[model samples]
Each structure stands twice: as C-alpha cells, then as structure tokens.
Target: MKALRRPSTAVNALLALLIVGAAFWGWTLLKDTDSDTGANASGLRTLTVEQGTVTKTVEADGSVESASTATATFGTAGTVTAIKVKVGDKVTSGQLLARVDDTGAARSLDLAEANLDAAEDALGRAQDAGTDTSSATNEVAQAELAVDEAEAAVAGTKLTAPMAGTVTAVNGTLGGSSSGAEGSGFLDIADLGKLQITAAFSEADATELKEGQAATVTWNALQGAETTGQVVAVDPTATTDDSVVTYGVTVSLPNPPDGAKPGQTVTVSVITGNVENAVLINSAAVTTTGNRHVVTVVGTGNQQETRQVQVGLEGDDAYQITSGLTAGERVVIPTSTTTSSTSNSNNSGPGGFMGGGGGAPPGGR
Candidate 1:
C-alpha cells in the first residue's frame, strides 16, 4: 500500500491556529475571572475626612423613678383596725392612711387622769392643813407626763401620709398584723410632682460625668418621645452586684411629658465633652500598630501611606482625629464591596463562580 499520506502543511497550519485560538480564549477567560475577583485591581475605596462637632457621650440604660417617695407605716406595732386609703388615692400631708387598735391607749389615758385627780386632791388637803405641798405638786406633774405619753400613743396608732403624693401601694388589711416594715406598710406614696431617671454607669464612664451635665433621656415605651435633663447627682459610692461595680447617677427631668410613669425603662446619653470644627473619621478606620494608632491615607495617585493618628473624644462610631490627619484627606476603609466579596468567597468554594481570589481592595478588608 502507498505510504499514508502525511497531513499537508496548510492543514497542519489550520490545526495549529485552532489550538492557539482555544488557548488564547481560555487565558482571556481566566484573566476576566481574576479581574472580577479583585485580584490586582486598580479600584480603591476612600473616605473623605470631615470637620464637624464631635460629642463624647456616655450611654446608659435605666428606669424612670419618682423624685421622692414615702412609705407610710405605724410607728408602733398594733392590730390593724382600719384602712383609710387605697391604691391610686391622691393624698396630702398629714392625711390618715390607716388606723390601728387604740384600746390600750384609751385605758392608759383613763388611768393617768385618775392619778392626776388624786394628786390634785392631796395637794388641796396639804394646802388646807398648811403642810408642804411640794410632794403633791410633783406627783401631779408626774401624772400629767403620763397623760401626755398616753395621748401620743393614741396618735401613733394612726398612720398618716408624710407628704403629698399618690398612693401606689396599700398593704394593710382590717385585723391584720402591722410590723412597721416595708411589706407591712399601711400605704406607699410616691411624689409625682417631679420625675427623674436613675441610671448606673460603669466606674470609667462615671468619672467623666459631673453634676449639671446635659443629658437626653428617651423613654422606651413612648416612641420618638424624649426629655431633656441634667445630671443632678453622682453618688460617690459605687454599688456592686455580681462582681460588677457601677455608680448611681440621678438625672432630673424638669419637664417630663405626661404619661411618663415610674419604673419605665429609658436610655440616657450624657454629653461629656464636645469639640467643634474638629477633624473626624469613622472609628473603624483606625488600626492599632505597635504602641500608636494608625490609619491608611490614600493620596491623589491612589498611593497609600500609613500615618500615626492622635484621637480624642471618641463617640459611638465616629472619632475625633486630633492630629496626623486633616479635613478633605481620603482614608482607606473596608468598603462595602470588599466585605461583600469576602462574604461571597467564604460561602462559595475556590472553584465556584465569582471567586474573589484577593477578596479585598488595597488597604481594605
């Protein structure tokens, strides 16, 4: 048989061209994928530093409380004979809230009166006989003292409101035992004339607070409703619970809205300090390096320079950059795009589509 005809050069050239074309196509596809994954990408995200007022605040949560409260109880223990007040009753000072048994007080008063009469008779007899009446006079004075004591005991049996307020609780019942303690009080009165918020702050935050500092209180139950207040008191003593020490802070709400009741949860933000016309940046843009805080600054040519930063009055998410950065300078931060790319890469395997090989932009996440 004739020797197998070798493929011609023209045919070979076409086959070579097809193979090279396929290789080039595959390489282009890979290049496109790498670009999409942000590998060696030129796009960079930057934030424009701004100048504004930055306020340093201490945030705390606490419950609304009355400015003053009074729990009325008997000074002496006795059988509860009557309850003169009920919950929600508005009372004035000296108003009777309850009454206890006064039978013993009555008997004591009668005995004292009989003694006084006998002493007076003896005194008259001594005067008539022209003997010394000093002993009889002393006896009469003693009897008068006993009578006053008996009268005070009778008054003590009545529980009276110490101040004008609304009765919040009544714990006394007819014929019930009264012990003059909290749970056995005849009534509980809360002075609703002025409202206040009591919050506890950590020792570190409490140090920054002082009396007369401005505060903003937002009631959780009343949406969009807030009241202005001032720091009235900061207890020098710290209260410790569960190994956590917190200082008590009292905020006075001079004009709390109606319907704001005691025991309502509230959030308070106390303005500790404020800097006007200060360079500010996002707090997250800061990164710690060695002993100093630093931020990546992006220059006009997209060149990055890590510079040391001096910060002051750090707020919730913004920071007062005192030095090392100025207004209008662009600083690199972890952009939302970079975050999305990283999240996608994490969920999708390396071979998966949309592979973010690099995952972040330069100086970004």
Candidate 2:
C-alpha cells in the first residue's frame, strides 16, 4: 500500500518547488548577514594626524567673593549717641564709625584720679613719721591701675573702622542700645576692589592645582563676560560631604569686569598642561596595550597596521604624539559596535573586545 503512493506526479512536482523556495530563502538570509558585516567593517572612522597645540584643563564651578573684609563694633556697651558713617561710605582705618554715651566712664575716671592723689599723700606722711609705708604704697598702686582702666573704658565708647573699605552695613542708630547690635557689630566693610573666586574641585582634579597657576573665569550672570585670574591658594585638607571629597581652591581676579559683584556664579578653567607645535591625533584612535600605546594606522591601498606610539600630553580631546607617528598620517578609530558583535559571536564572556579582564580600549584617556 505504501509503494502505490509514489505514482503521483503532481505531488512530486510540488515538493520540488517547495525545496527550491526554501533554499532561496536560506540564501537571502546568509547574504543579508554578510552584507551587515561588510557595512559595519566599512563604518570604521579615521582621522589624519597633524601638528597643533594641545591643552589639558580642569574645569569647575565657583562663586565670586570679596578678598578682604572687616567688621567694626564698639568696645564698651552704652546708649548709642551718634553714627558717623552710613552704608556705602568709603572710610580709612581708625576712622570713627559711631559713639556711645560715656557719662559713667568719665565719672569713674575722675573718682579714680582723686583716690590715687589721696593714697600718694598718705604714703608720704607714713615715710616722714618713720612708719612702715608698704600698705600705703600698695594702695597708691591699686588706685593708679583703676584710673588707667577707667580711661580705657572711656575710650571704648567710640567705635572705629578697623580697615579702609566701603561700609556695606550699619547696625547702629541714634538712641538705640549698643547691646542690640552685638551679633553683627555696628558696621560691616569689604574691599570690593580686590575680588576672588572660591571653587571646590574633586580630589582627583585638585591634585594638579597649585598656587600661581593661570586660570580663565567666565561669569554666569553676564553673557560674554570673562577674565583672567591666578590661583592664590589651595586647601591643604579635603572637605568631605556625603562621602564625596573635594578641595577648596582660591583664585584671585586682579581685574574684574565692571558690574562684577560678590555672590555671582562663575566657571573656572585651569590650564594644567599645554604643548605647541606637537604632532597631535584624536584620542579616540589610540588604545592601551599592556605598557604601550597602540594605534591602527591606515596606509596606502587601505591597508591597516597597528603600531606603538609615544604619547606626550594627554589633552581633553587630543593626544600629543611625541614619536612613532608623523603628521599627515591617517589613524583608524575602532568601532565598539562591530568589535562587540564579533566578540559575542565567538561566545566571549560578558565583556566585548578588549573588555572583561582586558584593559581599556580606544579613547579611554
């Protein structure tokens, strides 16, 4: 019965057509996969090495602040009698700022002087009568000390500026108690001419910072406003917050633009390294191999060769090629996507090419 079923010609012809269609479909899939591989290989990017300047910089956010500031307050507490300076008044050091009532201080000074005169007369009388004068002499010395303290108390009634600056605040007013302005003092002054920028940089970035390093500052409030500054100080200790550590850096702006004021936000860029007339190439084209830097250079006829290169200044975008590469040469930038796909096809563990236990690939620096 099974042998009788092979006599049908129509069924055999249909089977032949089905087999052909299956083979064609299989061929199309294989062709597509090959095409995809070719496209990915052709997508490799290349760059031409050239001579230029490479600069390495560290950027941070900061705020403008006054370099020097002072606060003036009265030395003695009394009724505020007068205020000599107002807010925005420019005054020099030792200038009187305000005065307090000194009636009690002056009375104490007069009484102390009278007591000292009486004690001295008693000491002279003791010596003339040939009696021990030690007790009388001690009384005269104590009276003299009281007089000096009373004089100091009277002088303390006047509040004066400790430094030359424009008065930014005035807390005292006529007839007010001097004790009322204890917290902020009677006046606050700042030297606005000397401006500085205070910025916090990550511990990793702060290692390259030092005093006297040049910096460029850009104001966030003012468009197109910028100025040059110098690094005046770097904190010796790190400040930690939420487990993140940073260092405080102070930059002095010698010539600030007009309208620049304290508390304004700014961006600071410090040039850490610079090289001129050096052979440079895109950092993406270089890869680290063990202890050497390797690059894929494309030569004539589209041939490629991997060679070791000596990298000098590792800039933000480009690398300074010190040797093993000349200007006008083309270097290939390895495409991660293609490399990753090839690695997966071979059943390589979780990481892709130059990944896993391997070191960093191109552009890692």
Candidate 3:
C-alpha cells in the first residue's frame, strides 16, 4: 500500500486562511440580515383614530396646609401663669388658651376707673352750678379713654383662641416668660378640618390655571392616597427664586382623607383643558410644518396621504383632532432612522436613536 503523504506547511497555511475568510463572510451576511430586520421592524407603526376624552393637565409639586390658621399670643408681656391647652388640643374661638399674671393690668384698670369717676363727678358739679364745664368735660373724656385702654390691657393678659382649630404647637411653658417666644407667637393653631394645598407652578403652567378648575392631589407620605380638590386661587404676582419665576396656586381640599396633615408633600394635577366625545389621535402622528399641523393617513390598499389637520386641546399622550380626521382612520407614526453612517456623520456617538439629540422622544408630545 502506498504511504499517504502529510500536507505541506504552505498548503496547511492556505487552508487556515480560507477557513477564516469564510467565517468572516458569514459574519458579514448575518450582520446585514440583522440590520434589514431591524429596519423592517421599525417601519410603518400605525395608530387608529378613535372617539374619546382628552384632558390636558398641569402637574406641580405642593404641600398640604391649613386653610385657616391663627397664631395665639399674649398681648401684654408677663410670666405665663397657666396653659389651658397642649399641642394637638382642639379649641374653639374665644376659648382660653393661656393666661399671664394680670396683677399689674388689673391695678391699672382700677386706677383708670377711679380717675374716670372723679372726673365725671367734677363735670356734673360744674354743670349743676351752670359754670363753664368745658375743662371738666375734657378731663372726663380723657379719663374715659384711659379706662378703655386699661380694660383692653387687662384682657390682653389672657390669650384666647381667635378661631376654631387644633393646636399644632405650644411655644410657651408654664412659668416661662410669655414674651420670650418671638415671631411665631406662643401657640400655633390650625383648622385641620379645612385643608388646602399650596403649590408653586411655573409661569407657563400658572397661566392655564383658574379658579374652580378641578384638581387631583396625591400625598407623598401616604402611599396610594389621593383626593380631589379645586383651584381656589392663583397669585397674580410671581415669586422669583434664583431668577426663576413661578406663581403660587392654592387648591381647596373640601374632603381630605385621614393621615393628610399640614406640611406633607403632595402632587397636584389640575385639569386645565378637557373635551369629551372628541376625535383623538396619537400626538406623535401630527407634525407641525410652519403654522400648519399635518398627519400621515393610511387608507385602503395601504395608500398614504399627508393631510392638514386642525389640532385642539393637546393632552399628555393624545391630541384632540378638531378636523381633517375621523374615527376608524389609521395614521402612521414616522419611523426614526439612525444608521451607523448617519450617526457617525452627525457625531452622535452611541445609542443612536435617542442619544442623537434629535426632536423630542416618542410619546413626549
């Protein structure tokens, strides 16, 4: 039998080179196939026009606050002799909240009263004698004024609830100086039964908000807790912080759920515009050209036409089609193409479609 000859080094090297070339060719074909598949998958996405409700809303961060609040403090400076209520105590208007030493106040009141009595007696005697009583009458009037001031000072020693509310904070302690607490008063009371949300919204958002606009509030502290409210007021003036302008908006929460308290953060979404039973379409399908809006409509036999449309209230995700479109009509969302060549030419380095710095992302309109 003839001995089989082993392959030469040159032949073996050539075979290895051919194998590498075949593998590279297969890889190239596979990459091309994937690119074609991706292009097909991204093409011709369509949405059907339908009759529905479209609501446009403006969202803002806010905090819960009492609609009615009163800060109770002693009008006259003195040591706090009594504290009738503690933090969290419910109180009514005119209810005694705290008391200070009234000794000096009472003495001043008594002295004023005695002076007024003496001055009035003098006036009466002068009048009975038919002599000039102008000076005596003036003295009586001055004394009466002093008496009124003294009475007011006496009443000022006792701090009373100015309105019905729950005591949120007590700054003064028994035996402490009533005047020691400054700025915030001795007691902080808030009408917890009546709550409202105060939010600062951007100038653009505030323009759309008006009194009586319906709103929904969600608490951050309370998981999944939400309630309805109404726009009670919008500030005419703008508040500036770091040169950024915003307006204050107040929303009344007629009936808030339990656990909602003042200072708790909340999210407020006010429905600025709403339309029911209107023809609506995906906002992405509409493109603005100059001053007109247009959409790509797909009809029978896959016929496509670019038609001008009248756009109405634009919502978060849907747009109200005022005209030029009807229910059951299909509209195409233009495909976003980002090939390697295009991406390199645009200098948009990786993550082509989104990172390209193009128009607003899908669903952003």
Candidate 4:
C-alpha cells in the first residue's frame, strides 16, 4: 500500500529530450532575428550602397633623424686637452669645438725651427765656402720639409665643427686618453635644422609608398608640434629586423623650430588613401564567388538580387565600385549573421574587381 505506482526512467528521459530540443530551436531563431535589426539589413554577397566621390591617400611610419651627422675626433695623437662645446651647444661650421694639448706639438715645432735655422746658417757658410754650395742648398730644402710637417702637426691641435649643428655627445674627457682613429667619436655634431625621418615599410606596404609623397610626423620630444614632410628617398634593398622585412623610406622634415635633435623618437603618418563622397560600402558586405563580385541589391519591391558588380578600390571602411553598382543603389551590407567575403585579386579581366576590390576613388584634380 505504501509503494504507489511510479513513472519509469525511460518515459522521463523522452520528455527531457523534447524540452531540450525546443530550447535549441528557439535559440537559432533568436540569432537570425538579431542579424536583421533595420529595414536595410545586409547579408553575404551584399553591400550597403553609398554615394560616390574621388580619393587620395598613403600610410607609413618613421623616426626623426639629423640631415647631416658629423662625428668629431682627434686630429693628431694626443690626450684631449679641452672640450669647448658641451651637449646642446649650438655650433657653427668651422667653429672650434674641442682642443688637443699643443704643448708637445709646439715643442716639436720649435725644434723644427731651430733645425731650419741651423740649415740656413750652414748653407750661408757653404755659399761663402764657394764652388761646393750646390749640396748645401739641398740641405735647406730638406730642412724646409721638416718645418712644413711640424706646422701641419701644430694645426691639428684643435678640433673644428664640420657643420652648423648642435653638440649631441662628448665621448672622452680631457686627459682621459683616446685616439679617435677608430669608430669612437670624441664628439657628435648633428644639424637639427634639417631633420630627416627614417621610416620602415613592409614589402606589401612599400608598393604604395614612394618618394615625394606627403607625410605628417609627430614626436614625444616636441609636444604639441605636428611636423610636415615628404618622402625624400626609398631604399632599394629590403632590410630584415625582428622577422619583418621592410624597405627604408627617408622623409625630409620641414624646418622645425629651434631645439630639434637627432635620435629622438618620432611617429610618421603616411596616409595610404583618403576618400571623399565615396560610395561607402561596409567591407564585410562585398563577397567573391570566384573571379566575380556578388553584391546583393535591394529594389523598391523589397526583392534582394545578387548583382554581378565590377568593383574597384577597396579600403577599410568602404569599397569603390567603378561600375556594376551606382550611387544610391541599396546593396545589403554583411553582418554577424554571415561570414566575411573574399575578393578575386588575381582574376584577369577588365570587369573583374579583385583584391578586396574596394579602392580609393580616382580623383580628377
């Protein structure tokens, strides 16, 4: 009597499965509805058509460097006697920047002078001796050579600035000892008035980068200062650093305000493309079904048709459709409901829009 009839486990399991199945079915429907929130929602092989206008642009990065870099060193073998210019000193070309002790050099010069005098006296006496004076004149010439050598040594006692710039570094101190014949620089002089930017671009990006392209640069050193410049040069060879092979792009900075220096960190902006009044299509909407651009165009009848469009330049925010699509055409822009579309970049045809086929519009001016 106490044990009443109870439901079997198999019956309960069947009911549980029906409940779970319904929950999954409802979830799928909710996801599909979320994808279409507006009247002009987008989907695969589709683009939300935008108005048209032309565009111009390029993008790159680089650092600010000196136009002219000069390293001052010991002209002759001697301990550094004095350094006239310190870091940050504005020096002009040919200005004295450093001095090596002339004490030994001057003594050598005196000795040379004495020897020259002795030779002159000997030559004078030899002329008085007569008939044998020819060889004595040769001795005068040899002594004169010694004097010239001594004079040159004395001239090298001072280090002069080779260009108009600021002193950026002082290597060794006076009496600390250093022969600058090696790469060790006694002082560094850099012309900040003429700043240059050394930019690095990937091989793919380098195709868009070229000399004479306009650029804007910014630096942490010069707060609030935006620098304007142009691409001055491009390295023909590729350089590999940190596993990235890049081409060097040199940009000539406009005359910055006084106080610019070399080795300062700088950021450069090279706009790859800039567009105006462009037929703005969300990049996700455009799809490639093999050598063809499949864009969904919505008509006044609310019918969605997959239109074969001849697309053009592709960008981050929009695609440039040269043909196959018109201004104010309603193309469906893809959303989370579908996957992003690919482009037929390698397709060979006049009407084939390839390579993520949205490019900056062509400008007349």
Best by TM-score: 3
lDDT of predicted model 3: 0.80
Query: Local error of candidate 4 at 333, Å?
Result: 2.5
Instruction: Give a tens-digit lDDT track for model 4, residues 169-266.
Output: 88878786646435677888887677788978878878887777778787768777777888888899999988889988898887664556666767
Q: Compose the digit string of candidate 2's lDDT tens values, residues 1-365.
A: 66777777669999999999999999889766644333224454565666666778898999998899998877888999988888889999999889999999899999999999999999999999999999999999999999999999999998888999888888777999775466787788999898899999999989999999999999999999999999999999999999999999999999999889988999999988877777876665689767699898878776889999999988766678899899777667677533543443233211111221122222322
Worst 10 residues of 2 by lDDT: 348-357
Model 3 stretches with alpha carbons more than 4 Å out: 1-42, 337-365
TM-score to true structure, per model: 0.74, 0.75, 0.77, 0.68
Which of candidates 1 and 2 reaches a greater lDDT?
2
How are the candidates ranked when ordered by lDDT, highest leading? Answer: 3, 2, 1, 4
Give, for candidate 3, the lowest lDDT window spanning 10 residues.
348-357
On the 0 to 100 scale, the lDDT of residue 140 in model 3 is 98
Worst 10 residues of 1 by lDDT: 348-357
Residues 125-235 of candidate 3 have per-residue lDDT tens digits of 999999999999999999999999999999999999999989999988899988646667999999988899999999999999999999999999999999999999999
lDDT of 2 at 17: 99
Candidate 2: residue pairs that collide: none
Q: Count the backbone clashes (under 3 Å) in each candidate.
A: 0, 0, 0, 15
Residue 248 displacement (Å), model 3: 1.4
